[model samples]
Target: MYKSKIKNQKLKNNTYTIAVIGSHSALDVCRGAKDEGFKTLVIVEEGRDKTYADYFKSRGPSTSSGPTGCVDEVLYVDKFKDVLSVKIQNELKKRNCIFIPHRSFEVYVADYDAIEKDFKIPIFGNKFLLRSEERTEKVNQYDILKKAGIKYPKIFKLPKDIDRLVIVKVPEKARSFERAFFIADSHNSYKHESETLIKEGKITKRDLEICGKARGVWTKYMAQKRVFDTGLLSPTEQAELCQVVKNKVPDLEDLIQEYVDKYLY
Candidate 1:
């Protein structure tokens, strides 16, 4: 069984130790630990792109096989479960190591809780608080926008909403041309050759040709109205943007505040 040490409790040995698992984006953490004179161990998957390894090697740290003139050592663990095994846990315990899982792996509340319970190591960030705070902030921001009467385009989810002159947007995998569409309001509309709209009889071969002629995948079905682009960023723009973002994505601000509170302040 693992024992819990209170916050600020020094390690048995004056030396600090840290094990970072799946550390893709948390390279800074490893670097920081090393700078702090901690015996740092990083475990990454072998099949992954070797950018991380190359980075560490170039920096003259260590290799996965063992220590190589770096701060400590690097280990290439093939599986996630291997890090939690008895052998690995025993080794970590022998060194009184703290385990910090990589943030890019979609960490869950249960994962942090389990690590704290099983390994008796402190994982930065409260799982439940962070998740809840982010969700609440987003919802609140959406509500604020609605209340402030900011006009946004109606979100269409169905193909039937695609009239002769209608815009089609693919939000998830949207790119340059895919980001938005301004369909011309025409009585005789030509349909584009999109698999989604093609099956719905919304587009035809002629439409495909026209769309192909255009720079992007979305083609205007009808002659569009003259729309002025009022794209100026003013003081009001900045304030409104900040308010909207704070209301909708409060968690982002919260995270910044958390970091300041923890490290800076």
Candidate 2:
């Protein structure tokens, strides 16, 4: 119940109130909300940032718990679910706030009924947020991509070409599998390790068989080809990209536009 900003300010029933969780991740929604005359409330667990929260001490002393620019008030909570509880949101008492979550906290966005039931705060989000959060539940994304006519690298065969430095990788869907994290440069190393793990009883024959089947991710995309990727990703660009996508604007599509409109030539 941090009330420094709200102490004297008139709490409006008509003006929209936006509650942001990942201020570093989805700052656009905060700025946009403020621009549209919506009161912004940023919620921080330990006063962290929006994206990864690795080293996000981005806030100044004036706000401390919250960042400036788009934020009106900053609220800190000991627990995540507590903020969603009616007992906690009742601390806001009369102010009407819409909980529009950023992508970093999109998991909570999927819990629409529970959040709405407890906080009675309407989110200005849609089913797309839920879909984004449920990406882990989907293991058939490659099949879906194939259906979309998107091309992928060629699959490998056993006793395949090892001299060419064939790539062995885990499928995107099955990347969570404990043993699938490795990426071997050549077929020989991959085969040797798989067999070694099976022999050591660390992986069973059935597990090996299943892994082999799913190991179609081993592709011949860069077979003997020296590839040079240009402008792949930079820290500043990626950071800007992360900040821009959380709201509805979507990807560098919106950010690039913002840059051109505001700063670029």
Candidate 3:
């Protein structure tokens, strides 16, 4: 129904604006939108509006004076969640804005149901995909990857199955969003690392047991590829992997092109 509304209404002055929350990937999103000739609007928290509304605010279209910053408009809200308010949504609708969700949107809005059902704006990407990041969700990224037949890291069902170099991933004791890892190659090594972490108060014993126990992956293969084990992802390897997937799954290539043609034009 919301999509129908977007399809039926003519944009004001035939102008479309790209809107995004003012954190995480906001600068990148706004910059890309402005480069593509779309007006950019950022919804920022009151204290944080300075970056978008002041520093990167657009001076006007590009000119001989050199390039202006990307952001065109900034809407200040008391809190990020205020963006879901009907008043805010209506204001965005008046400007013919299509929201582009990012990390901040999922982290601050934090409610998948509200984002999918209550927020009545046209979103440029799949909002439902946001919930899949939560491992506690009934169906998550791992499940989706498995169904798509995408090759991901192998999961050990038990600690005893860990026989090669492996990393136990767990959330930091204070910062849940950030991951803390300890490498181990066997049951003894796993126990030793986990105990060290617990003794250092870097992670809770419960979290180490529940989250790290069966999540260890044989990461020597990744190290051999000079990837994740090095604590960095190789862009070259990433591109090659993508190409391999596209060649192996012809339907996925078509699906990606379809999305690009429909949403990106």
Best by TM-score: 3
- Put the candidates in lDDT order, highest first: 3, 2, 1
Candidate 1 lDDT, 1-265, residue by residue in tens = 1334422233432375766764443455565565445666666678752545565642433555444323255566666556655677677777767766543432422253344445444444433333222211334333444678985444333344445444443222222122223243332332332554556544444444443433223322332223322222543354212111112112334545756886897
Estimate the Cα RMSD of every predicted model relative to the unseen true structure: 16.7, 13.6, 12.8
Taking the tens digit of each residue's C-alpha lDDT, what string does model 2 give over 173-216? Answer: 33223333233446676777566655655556564554456535
Report the Cα lDDT for candidate 2: 0.51
Best-performing candidate as measured by lDDT: 3
Inter-residue clash pairs, candidate 3: none
Candidate 2 residue spans exceeding 4 A from truth: 1-14, 22-26, 46-68, 91-93, 106-119, 127-132, 138-265
State in Å the error of residue 216, model 1.
Answer: 31
Superior by lDDT: candidate 1 or candidate 2: 2
What is the model-wide C-alpha lDDT for candidate 3? 0.74
Q: What digit string (tens of lDDT, one per residue) describes model 3 on residues 118-219?
A: 998999757888888866576778889889999877777667778876656777898766667656679787888788888998988876666633323223
Off by over 4 Å in 1: 1-14, 49-54, 58-71, 105-119, 125-265
lDDT of 2 at 252: 38
Q: Please, what is the whole-model Cα lDDT of each candidate in the order they appear?
A: 0.45, 0.51, 0.74
Error of 1 at 9 (Å): 14
